[model samples]
Target: MDNIISKLRNLDAYPKINEDFYSRTLSGGVITLSSSILMLLLFISELRLYLHAVTETKLVVDTSRGETLRINFDVTFPALPCSLLSLDAMDISGEQHLDVKHDIIKKRLDSHGNAIEARPDGIGAPKIEKPLQRHGGRLEHNETYCGSCFGAESADDDCCNSCEEVREAYRKKGWALSNPDLIDQCKREGFLQRIKDEDGEGCNIYGFLEVNKVAGNFHFAPGKSFQQSNVHVHDLLAFQKDSFNISHKINRLAFGEYFPGVVNPLDSVQWKQETPSATYQYFIKVVPTVYNSVSGYTIQSNQFSVTEHVRTAEVGRLQSLPAVFFFYDLSPIKVTFTEEHVSFLHFLTNVCAIVGGVFTVSGILDSFIYHGQKVIKKKMEIGKFS
Candidate 1:
């Protein structure tokens, strides 16, 4: 045992260590040294590659108007890498000749390839530039031709005609047939007129003749150099004609309910304008259609009039609202319109890649720092043992 101890001491006293000891120390040092060196080398290579990418990157954009734009980015080391390089170019001069032939083919197939008939080629009938004149003659009223009664012809004088049948059917439900005066009022005012007697028993009676004159004569007046411009006058005229038809339908529906009686006779009526500055106002006219024998009369108004002033007020209020709020979807109402637009996929893809790369780089750096500290602590322990 003493000899063995002496041999062990002699081994320790030697200038050179044993092969196993040297090998283990060298292996551990190489592992730590190589890891640090490799990490630095990899980091430097990545930075250079990133810088190169940034310096060479470019983008080009072209538009239908023969305009072009080119953008260049400056190359940076840690701040900017080749991978971060970006450039934008825009060209605004190319003609966008939409290939609508495909759409036409699709539509044709949908229609079973039926040949579309072409509109007749000729000058259309002369437009009615002036309003129809109102004659002073009274509209003839025949008992057999009562407007309130359905299907009553002027030539038919029979009391048991279709009109009488309809009236008899209403009489069974306590609804008296409209009288001659009420029928005449409908012809003049374009609505059913109701009149009440002193006993509160009412009859559909006509009395007043209301005439509405054309408020304005709107005609298209071409500019002084109309012939020189590319604007098609015929197209404009067609548009105006269509617009007039639409406007007439809307106006008729809006104001038709108020005719004969402007206010409800059953209830105490009240009127309030939403805005005084409004060029157009919507006037609600409520009328009681169903009469309650016990409650005197139950008036239920559901009609409204949209005057020109109301439209002006709405447009003025819109200006005060924020553009973002106006464009945001806050209501359940959904509107869709067909229009050509650019795709947004490219913008989304770039944004995602940039965010992902930043996180990946940060994680790699943290790992390197943590591993380096652990290796240094191990080396210190090994030195103390030596």
Candidate 2:
């Protein structure tokens, strides 16, 4: 009992020593608390960075059949190859062959075997007449006849006797007589025939004739197949212009069998088809891999790989992750593709930012308050000892 009382009385005399010890202890405590909070904030920040590295993006492609194929995947993956993709055309079916005749005859012939000539009266001419009309005539006994007519009697009013004079007059005026040589010249010149029959009939005319030799059926075959890669994501989403060529022979006469209502095959057919279809369907398979690293408190995402369909006619577009990140490692690690996978990363990043912000502000305020308190407490201690 005496020893315990002696210890209690000596405790009051040790105030200076106790005061120094308490101040040191409080300072250490504050430092330790601040350090712990900083560590927690760093951990949260790291978690947020991991979430930002992995996101999914959309992929799309246009095909030759005017079809569009869309798929969702990461942006970092490569497209697939063509042979693995399949295509089945629904509209064209069955096998049919078309036959056409190339040999055709083109000749001009008259109604009779013998080529006819113009008559002396400038009528029924096998050759075309120049301005087909008669201009001049002779008067005989007050009756009109051709300029070569003769009178029946030797009368003073004989217009036939004056026929020679009128004929000469008309000839001098550049009028054409019924000359056999002129008619022959016109016939040999290959002019279009304009003939007046001996019965005073009208002109005769003729035109060309055409014949068609069509086959019973038509044929269709598969065209060349190709693959395209490194396609831009924007081009696939909208309509685009594209073309491909197919080498094949088409029969001229049987062209109607395949292309109905086409008048001329050589003129109407495009030897090579232009403007491929703007829509396509694609089947994309994607594998996502992630790699993350932390260097000096900053996290970064690395490269990734992907497999996809790359055929022009069969499939288009590919699959990939929208975003990706690694967690404290540099080696690539495989990850499963999921629709809701981004939620966790988003939540973690946000929480880290919030916690980091709060702790940083609190530390600043606490540091100021601790420094002020220390100054005032030191003054109080000094005054007590004095």
All candidates: TM-score? 0.17, 0.17
Residue 261 shift from truth in candidate 2, angstroms: 52
- Give all candidates' CA lDDT scores: 0.26, 0.28
Q: On residues 349-376, what C-alpha lDDT tens digit does candidate 1 reach at each position?
A: 5445544554465556555665676799
Candidate 2 per-residue C-alpha lDDT over 1-386 given as tens digits, one digit per residue, 9 for 90 to 100: 99999989898855555554444447557766876787677766666665554433332231123321111111110111110111111112221111111221112123331223311111122222221112232233534332222222234442322322332233333232333223222333322132212111211111111121111111111111111252111111111112212221122211111211113222222122222322211221222222222221211111222221222333465432111111111122323221223466666776667676766776676677788888999999999999
lDDT for residue 180 in candidate 1, whole number 0-100:
27
User: Candidate 2 — which residues are off by over 4 angstroms?
Assistant: 1-23, 56-65, 68-367, 378-386
Taking all chains together, the TM-score of candidate 1 against the true structure is: 0.17
Worst 10 residues of 2 by lDDT: 74-83
lDDT of 2 at 202: 14
